[model samples]
Target: MADTQRTSERINFVHQDEIWKAHVKVEKDSAEVWPRKWGFLTEAYKEFERDSVKLKEVKVTPSHHLATRPLTPPEKYTNVGPSPPVPQTTQALIGWRSAHSRLQLEQHGQVHHGRRSFLKVLGWPRDACS
Candidate 1:
């Protein structure tokens, strides 16, 4: 008997006849500590799209985070309709303490302070701080 192999096909949700290909150029900066890699150039190719209809491409550099992009109104058409509603989220406050601190507090019924002060308060000999 001969072994059979099955080929897998990509299932794209958008069944549009158009196809898009993106090429990216990445650059790594030399650093004595931590080096960060970022994409410098990005080129997009669209199949079946007219060459005259150029898509707006934004090149994000490593320094992009340092400055904010200036907002410009659309030159061709006016933006209409009400803005989308902001998402509502709930925040929670969480805290943690060391087990050793908890143990000392449980055993001595005391809170945060130096070891010497804590011992001295418990009638134990206090050592030189030096």
Candidate 2:
């Protein structure tokens, strides 16, 4: 009985192995004629190559402002007589403050709406316009 059971299990294993091998063969044959598979792969590779070349061309060049050489002060510095004091109008001051506030809010990921922090403070209600 033990030998008979072993022989049956071996046969089942062989059958499963044969089925797997046949499946692999079928996949290999089908893949050979897959529409534009190779062409698509080659085109994808070419696109990657093109992008790589473009990226290389766009690599950041060092700017003069960031150069390692020591910066020398300007040769001539003239101080013109005290300039006349400029008057600040309320509206201009308010506009400047608003602009500054907006910049600060933007830095903190908050939207600015010209004196309306109601919508911004409440996590910017979903329906709010961008």
Candidate 3:
């Protein structure tokens, strides 16, 4: 349908643009901006696609094993030792999810959870989100 068409179009656009980059014919000023503004999306889309396939083989349900567990505050956690820092890409993904959820709540009166919100932002075909 329309969603599939849009996804294909985006893939085609990225492929063609990459070809242009390889040819060294890119407009440098704009080229520098393009990847910074949207590079995570392309990478995220690929990841989402890979995760979707793997998810299909497992039971889909929320786990509450630790929902009632006592939590360590950040101050306590940090005092223990230096933990590995979150990568820039992970930070960006967190920001996107938070912002998207907020926007949906404000505009649509409902929030789309992780997978649907992610696919919606990427304009990918959303088979299901629940």
Candidate 4:
């Protein structure tokens, strides 16, 4: 009951803030700062990414790239190469089964395999999902 009330209050507060924001006048300074803010954020993200342990510098191999002899994109901007392949439904099912098996290892209850894991993968609580 308390949790429900808190959720409702949080939702109400969010809606109220949205309503106020919609009516509030935009300042020229706020518009001007957007590009500067994004530039700073992009630079910071690049710096952090460079320093991250997971980031590895790769030397490009000569054979790695395809020469654009025939289907070469114009000197100007153009969509290059092939689009990504569509994923099969079984791929998702496999992921769900794996995650559910992991969850089953943690808990006492019997996991309903794909059904329970489908909810887990979709970010739904097991009890609420049912």
Candidate 5:
């Protein structure tokens, strides 16, 4: 039928027009714009490098005291053995106790005892007290 043919032709024409408009828009937005932007960034970085060199020349001096102090060797009597492996449950308990002790110290200016003593004071399970 001619009516169906005319409707199909109209639909095809609209679709082709949309595709042409998209192509035109893409062409108008330069394909080289991204490369040009990167070139500008590189030029800016070179300028920054030049400025930094000039600043260092003006401000840097000998005897700037940048060398680190030599580390003192440990005492001969100090124990240097590998630390004992802590169980996961013990580690978690210790971490909790340490955090709690720090908070108590901050609030009261002192904790009653070290980690083990603090755990005992908190009445944590006997196993965790160790």
Candidate 6:
């Protein structure tokens, strides 16, 4: 009769195409530092709780607060479909087209040194800057 006790440990491997692997293993000790470590963490946590309570008790006026509340446009401008396409958007479109042309020219060993673009907005001269 042969002994059937297996001496080898089972192979533990991650099943994934990823490269990074990590794990932690701590040996048990009769007198462990874990208690002391936990005590220190608990003391720090209590201190943080006290500080948080102090923070909650603090009352600062909005004017004294460091963070500025962003200024959003009034409710009417929130929905954009009502307005027609503005001149700024048209200029932006033209700019994108010119940039594409420039890229193509550069690829073909050509240099474009002229001004990026010129936007001429044709509108009736305002009598008093409308």
Q: Best candidate per lDDT, number? A: 2
- Candidate 1 structure, TM-score to reference: 0.10
State the displacement of the C-alpha of residue 32, model 1, in Å, after optimal TM-score superposition.
49
Q: Give all TM-scores, in the order shown.
A: 0.10, 0.32, 0.22, 0.19, 0.25, 0.27
- State the displacement of the C-alpha of residue 74, model 2, in Å, after optimal TM-score superposition: 26
List lDDT for all candidates, in order: 0.41, 0.69, 0.68, 0.62, 0.67, 0.55
lDDT of 6 by residue, 1-130 (tens): 1223543644334532132322222234423767766668888899999999999999977674777878887775654333334346665766453354433435567676876323324444545343
Using TM-score as the measure, which candidate wins?
Answer: 2
What ranking of all candidate models by TM-score puts the best one first?
2, 6, 5, 3, 4, 1
RMSD of each: 32.9, 14.1, 32.6, 26.2, 15.2, 20.9
lDDT of 2 by residue, 54-104 (tens): 998996989999889866555546333443334387666554533544334
Error (Å) of candidate 3 at residue 8 is 42
Give residue 103's error in model 2 in angstroms.
25
Off by over 4 Å in 1: 1-62, 76-130
TM-score of 3: 0.22
Residue pairs in collision within model 1: none
* Per-residue lDDT value at 68 in model 4: 44
Worst 10 residues of 6 by lDDT: 16-25
Model 5, span 1-130: residue lDDT tens: 6646775454577787899999988877766576675678878899999999898889655574886777767775554444444547865756553454433336556556745666568877668834
Q: Which stretches of candidate 4 lie over 4 Å from their true place?
A: 1-32, 54-130
- What lDDT score is found at residue 109 in candidate 2? 75
lDDT of 1: 0.41
lDDT of 5 at 23: 94
